[model samples]
Target: MSTSRGAPGSVLAVDAGNSKTDVAVIGADGRVLGTGRGGGFQPPLVGVQVAVDTLADAVTTALEQAGADCVDHVSACLANADLPVEEEELAQAVQARGWGRSTEVRNDTFAILRAGVDEPRGVAVVCGAGINCVGMLPDGRTARFPAIGKISGDWGGGSGLAEEALWFAARAEDGRGAPTQLARTLPAHFGLASMYALIEALHLGRIPAVRQHEVAPLVFTVSAAGDPVARSLVHRLADEVVAMASVALGRLGLLTEEAPVLLGGGVLAARHPELDDRIAVLLAQRAPKAVVRVVAAPPVLGAALLGLDHVAAPAQAHRTLRAHYA
Candidate 1:
């Protein structure tokens, strides 16, 4: 008896992240028939099998709800697939499950990139829990980052900004740095009396380490209020984003051409006017022809669009899927 579980005309789309995974199944007609959400697919935390199994659960549910047994293409954009080898491994693993006839696995940043642009060409920088960038040109040229944090020489993400906030606050408290509003505000954020107390709480697990990401916005608030240290940190982040884009533009030989630079992830999507303005000014000076746009679409939309591309869906189908996702 033959035992394949799915039909062959649908597209399976998955956007797997560090915190959660989003899955969708789309028909050839551009109808989004089913969507499902599941746990994080971080292989570093949960082994590959567990992460793949988590993805399987979401994919199985999405297909079951769509009343489809299989799909022709699986397009997944996953977090922590920082290396080419990682993407290859994850792609093979996804293909092994028999959910689709073929599969394409890419860094999660590409999903954000593809979602914001009408074309596949341009650059995208995602600054969420961490930061990552990817760029592609019409001729198939591409640029990307290792995005493995300090080891990869990356900076300017929620965790990185939060670390800066705490560093300056601690210094201000000890008179090693200029007295800024953060000295008062950073401790008050956690309902503590001083930086020392807050530090102790975090050290002793009274305040979970994961909560550090919450401090990034406060860093913005202080910067907005005219704290020199805070302003520098924000500008530094803008510099980092600009550098990544400019380098990509150079790599793809698009520095003189008008190309879209899509910004996504929690940090960029928040649209802090000061940070946005700074990024714009720096980009204008650095890469004169790069057009910047903030991506508001969910990353899953990108994954779905990629799947549509995989099946050679018509341009109208892409438009329909974009609007349906919109």
Candidate 2:
């Protein structure tokens, strides 16, 4: 008798992040039968019910797109899906859908790691709407950052960049900190000309926290235009991420030139050549052998690949899975 338990058919894979949620239906051969997207499903904002509903909507759409009747399993990778209560809630909700015979819940970072490498016995640094790092040693030792955005001084993300610019601009305008072009550039971002007017507008509830994330692009643009403060901010963030990777590598004993450093996230995926060069330079200085690659596909696809691996033949299964993804 076989000691392993396997799926009876195909499966559904999901990647739920702070900005967006993606779902894919996969066949037994590891082919992506269909895919779909839904709104952000962070539980803190929408509640678990809302997140679950959003995920169900996306998964149903993927199945419809695939024209598939039944799925034997499900693997959902979601951001902030950390708490045991949250995991239980999500598991119960997905089990109701009966997409497959089994369901597994994991943090979205796990999917990012799986998406970048075949076995994921390495580190993955994700700097998307937020920034985080997760590393898994060959011995099953894992290390990850807390990754909380607000209420945590977590710096080095798109949202974090915007916030930093706002801070610098506020301080510069008040003559309380070093003068920066941000004081002038920020007013332009809001179609205003003066910092005083911008402050008045913000105090009157004209600007919200959600709108703050919009300013991140302006920081990047100003940095590219040779603004010293903006450039410093970007490089500082890059260095912070590199530091996180170094710590993760140190824990995993992958700090040498032998282990690969996998990069996966939205900020990295922007394909900013300058940013890439800067990251490479930092990695070479810090962890020379850490190979960096930008994962092009949704991390949920990687989670689905994991589900496929669970049921498929082992030796050539990875090749077949890669071929299907390709």
Candidate 3:
């Protein structure tokens, strides 16, 4: 529980996303001593041990910079630690590294939620390549969704939006659905003349499937230009965001009280006018006391705050940490 400088209550905070990982070492007084950034953590693809090994590289760099051999607590907010069992497994793997005296793992969405709020009490709905929601209270109670994709009753992430845009555009092009501008714009984005050509390119790997997420923003552009189908998709996404936020707020008993509904992830952070305005209207109708805000801070700050909270650090400690990030 002590650092090289003989400081107790030091924390190692980790925010591991699907694309990258960030690590920070904070003293008991909330001074950020050091930080490290490394590749993504994807246990589902690389296996747990291998994934934590990737994290170790960053952790080692951070600890070296901080002049600490270990920390009192390891607070890791990780992507793909979606379910409780997954969190437990990842926690065990992290603990086995002997990086800290204690370890806690949570879905990465909680990092965004915590990052956007002054305290632990708030709801966060993140719409990145995928969508997820989580709510928390300082008392340790939390509400969350499975967030494993369509099978988990979830929809409206960047990937989902891209897929939906393709579907409607394909249907429109083939005369199977109502005519829409998506039929033209979706294909044009890729320099193809027709949806059939775009479809062939996507199917034949001429255009990497990974590029599909790029279509999400194009959908917003079309919506802004008055495309009915594209506009509908944007509105649906807003609906999903509000639905997830309101439900999480209600579950945490924050629906009746004033609470922050923090929007995070690339899609929400972009603040598309249609999506933003629609979410505001719907959330106002559903959770009248909800105050919506898009989180601009890096989520690693949230992981660090959660660590300080775990150690019961004083309010000044939290302020100092926030100021460092600020």
Root-mean-square deviation (CA) per prediction: 2.4, 3.9, 1.5
When 2 and 3 are scored with TM-score, the better candidate is 3
| Candidate 3 lDDT over residue span 221-292, tens digit each | 999999999999999999899999999999999989999999999999998989999999999999999999
lDDT of 3 at 307: 94
lDDT, candidate 3, residue 273? 89
User: What ranking emerges by lDDT with the best candidate at the front?
Assistant: 3, 1, 2
- Number of the predicted model whose lDDT against the real structure is largest: 3
Model 2 segments more than 4 A misplaced: 1-9, 65-70, 83-89, 137-141, 150-153, 312-325
Which residue pairs clash in candidate 1?
6-69, 6-70, 7-70
Each model's backbone clash number: 3, 5, 0
Best by TM-score: 3
lDDT value, candidate 3, whole model? 0.93
Report residue 31 deviation for candidate 2 (angstroms). 1.7
Q: 1-326 in candidate 2: lDDT tens per residue?
A: 11112236477888888778888877665667788898887788777776688877787788777776547788888888754466677877777777767787767877777777777577878877788888875454777766786454467777778778888888888999778888998887888887787777777878765776677777877888888888888888788778888888888888864765667776777766557788889988989888888777668767886676555535355566576666
Which residue pairs overlap in candidate 3's backbone? none
Candidate 2: 10-residue stretch with minimal lDDT: 1-10
How close is every model to the real structure, measured as TM-score?
Answer: 0.96, 0.86, 0.97
Give the per-residue lDDT of model 1 (tens digit) for 1-326: 11124454468899999989999988886778888899888898877777899887888888887877778899999998899999999999999998889999999998998899887899999899888899986555679989999898899989889998899899999999888788889889989999999999999999999998999999999999999999999999999999999998899888999999999999999999999999999999999999999999989999988788777788888898899878
> Rank by TM-score, descending?
3, 1, 2
Error of 2 at 157 (Å): 0.5
